[model samples]
Target chain A: MNPQPSLNALQSILETLLPQMEQGKFSKVECHFVRALLEQFKNHSRVFAELELSTRHLKEALGETENAANTLLTLAEDLQRDERTEDIGLQISEACAFQDIVGQRLKLVQKTLYSYVDFLALMGTTTQTSPATIMSGPGFTGEVISQDDADRLMG
Target chain B: MAVSKDMPILIVDDFKTMLRITRQMLAQLGFMNVTEATDGVDAIEKMGQKDFALIISDWNMEPMSGYDLLKHVRGASKTPTVPFVMVTAERKPENVIAAKKAGVSNYIIKPFNAGTLKSKLMAVLGPF
Candidate 1:
């Protein structure tokens, strides 16, 4: 029987090369994914930007209503201390919080877009030679980690 | 330590929105004096210029990450012991371990609200 390319360094080589191959495969897939994401990103960015603008306009419009309501409540004893009257202020503040949450989510996708490009750029630079195993974790997904888990890891 | 409201907190993050939200949260908690740094390198440069009561930094930055900044800050005798809070969207145990080992005073995850920011600050800096 032939020397069987020797199981010698084969496992280590496989271990090393398999990961690279996997990453390369991912990089290939991500190239297309990035293009799609970029196109989506353009539309997404425009939509979110418009959404943010529209929300701000709505909030400003509500502010006028709120001012009117406040003035009415103060002058007209009928509207004063009413639950529905008070609810307007509360509702506007809550709605303002909604726009911010949308902004946060929009930022997450933007970061994801950056990561896709960065990853592709990195793989592009290292394709000829062995790619450095970037241990940097996946790109930001806007997920929150628990403090307990954080502490446990610290320990 | 019952820090004061005008404790001169430093907020570091690349995103304008994060910085704005953080500043708002700090303001809500009565931390009126706030400073902003766009990234870890910018943060290090600013910290080198003046001492801040606390440093709140986002973790994934280009070239100089929050982890890299933490290491540099810890290495520098000037602000080595300053309270550094690592803000990140990462959920990796090893990343947390890396920050903690790098001498982070506390950690705040992403999409955080004023309440979470308040609790983290209180935990690290004591009550206002």
Candidate 2:
């Protein structure tokens, strides 16, 4: 009995038998989950930005309303109430414009979510290997997809 | 700038937000007379109805990609000189080469800002 081949010798023998260990790495499903999570992170970021902009717009509108109220209060006492109503109207219009911006941003976020749905579908259908090549946004990653690559990955 | 702000410009994209954002970017550049089409076929229909001073279009679209539209525009009679700019989420060199070979005036990638849009337009329209 050769001491049952020392533990170090067993470790070296195992390394010789299998040089690559694929077991420890994340599977395709796990990778998909990771990619999807990253995508959600991006989606949340967009929503957060939208919310910030919306809040700014709301604040502006509130400030405008307050200005109008105060100015009207002081002016009513002085009998100049009709003078600054136009200013209030203009401010309201500007504030309303913010709604349009928020509307567009929300729509953009919706589109992003829709794309994410397609990605989720791909993840579900793909097997053996990660279906998507982990496509990257302009600044997020460097790989570019061509028409041919797109067809293959999509398949 | 040779191109006037009043000149009609056509923008084609599949996304509504992109259309609005691109229009807003153009507006920031003093271009108020901008028109939009949701896809290539829609853009072709619009193009048939009017002569745009400049045409800005997205590259990826269903049933008819921007490359196909570019080919149609390039092959169309009496519309050879129309400046066509292709915008895309894609940055593949092959697409860029194909677009340039098809006579695209300028190419810009997605996630672009006001500055990139402005510079790309200026490259095509000559310092607007």
Fnat (0 to 1) per candidate: 0.25, 0.10
Pick out the ten consecutive residues of candidate 1 chain B with the lowest summed lDDT. Answer: B108-117
lDDT tens digits by residue: candidate 2, A58-110: 44445545654665456555445466563443233222333333343344445
Candidate 1 residues A9-97, lDDT tens each?
44344445445555665466655554444444344444455445444444444554465466545544534556466445433332233
Model 1 misplaced regions, further than 4 Å: A1-145, A151-155
Name the best candidate (by lDDT). 1
In the order shown, what is each candidate's alpha-carbon RMSD? 13.4, 13.8
Can you give the lDDT of residue A106 in candidate 1?
Answer: 49
lDDT of each: 0.64, 0.63
Question: What are the models' TM-scores?
Answer: 0.56, 0.49
* Candidate 2 lDDT score at position B108: 72
